[model samples]
Target: MELERAVGTYLRHVALERGLSEHTVAAYRRDLDVYVEWLRARGIVDAEAVTPELVADFGAERASAEPPPAASSLARMQSSVRGLHRFLVREGRAETDPSGRLRPPKTPRRLPKALTIAQVDDLLDAAGPAPGSEDASAAQPASVRDRALLELLYATGARVSEIVQLDVDDVAQGDLLRVRGKGDKERVVPVGSYARAALDAYLTRVRPALAAKGRATPRLFLGVRGAPLSRQSTWLIIQAAAEGAGLTAHVSPHTLRHSFATHLLQGGADVRVVQELLGHASVATTQIYTHVSVDALRDVYATSHPRAR
Candidate 1:
């Protein structure tokens, strides 16, 4: 059978039987399409014609190309190729998987950039009405909502998707927030006093006004038209707040998340505790923040220790 046709069959199986999300399936399809094209160029359209060397050559070709693909992209492409060959073998279309031994390129560990506590404070202040301003009375419902959204993001370190998915009932006693993270996994994270106050203000003063604009929904954050806030809109909100705070650095929801974890680590929180709070599937993922804290300690030691220089 043609390798290209077999790729289509595998994609369908993943989408329908494995229940992978459309977004993930589409990504696999794109990567596999490139692989198929590469195979066709070598006059190897038949599945049985594929060899381990051919797969290795494909990786080398991508790596040596002008403006080579980033390590992450190359890794994803290799994963797609490996999955395709494995599927073909399982289906008896191929006697062996040529791409089985292929390994993904190693991506450098890029530590997440976290904002300082002061910067986070400034950002939150910018998201709401300025203190002692006469126009405080004129502050819009959207401003209140923005403040709550930012506060909740920092307080829980929840992804923007989780924050937007929140329902009114998700907030429980003791200022706990029940967050639904990736794969619909639920975890309860504590809300700080500042965040709780911000949420209270938005819920009591702003959400109702916005909800009146359209059909009522259980979503925590709503747009001007009362629809659930989109991920793009959430990013824009963070960007606008950062600009208002006079922060030239690029700030996104993930930045707030990084800050939350880093600040916790700097404050002596356990890595395992942070892992649970962030809903990371692995403690190894949470340990990255420890490196951020170590960097901070080194900076402090260099500046404050009298004999360091």
Candidate 2:
């Protein structure tokens, strides 16, 4: 009862005082709950009685898990235990923090996957509006909307959420686009002539029809009924496009993002400039393209080298 009471207080402290997000607090609670249940299963009732052996066993069980838990997840679990024990010590409920000495297992990082330039082109071409032959009574307005979505994604490499939130006025110029990023920070990225032409087509022939209402709405992408385009709907558009293009890989709007950064990097764009275009908060985040480049080189080497197999 005492340990349970302490756990509740600790949880409140993490939630109210630490100001961690609800998702994070809920996650910590879940991990700690699992740990406590595992302890109870072993008939270890007292917090002080929880030994290094128990912790080690838990770590080993988690590490040796099949379809193994990721190292990042294991690290989070370890962090939860450390926090719980530290709370117990602080409240004078325990004499030692058993989890203090525990270490999480290290795991290898998976390299990022990138599509070829030709594959990217195929994907983009596939992303355009559905054919008139497919649906004889087809809506040309929606077709324009779909084409604009594809063009904007490839043009700015903006996140789907950002793209869907765009205003028709935002894409007026073919030369530049203002992008709102994380924390509502905004930046201007240049758009190519191809994207501009697509946007012009949509604006001229498509947008006004979808948006029959005279009210001035700021949203860029519009639904058939003229509301802002949703993230879920954007996902469906990308999937349909990939299928149309006969792409075997699972692709998303972000695949275009990866392709955008990759193609730019291959074309000798500076890492910092790519960082700005992607609106990555850190240059380190942009350096991921370098990894993509290395992976491309590896694929070439594997194909060309005599003993690469």
Best by lDDT: 1
Where is the poorest 10-residue window by lDDT in model 2? 130-139
TM-score of each candidate structure, all chains considered together: 0.84, 0.65
> What is the C-alpha RMSD, rounded to one decimal, of candidate 1?
3.4
Model 2, residue pairs in steric clash: 166-220, 167-220
Residue 231 lDDT in candidate 2: 85
Measured with C-alpha atoms, the lDDT of residue 134 in candidate 2 is: 43
Candidate 2 lDDT score at position 136: 20
Pairing residues by index, what is the TM-score of model 2?
0.65
- What does candidate 2's lDDT look like per residue over 1-309, in tens digits? 345565678889887776654567888888888888888889876788888889889877877889988898988988888898888888787888888779876656655566787776776666664333244235466666777688778878898867877776676665999887664668899988777866776776777777785355778787877777888999998888789888899888888888789888877889999999999989998897787787667878999999999
Model 1: runs farther than 4 Å from truth?
1-26, 40-49, 87-94, 130-137, 172-174, 299-309
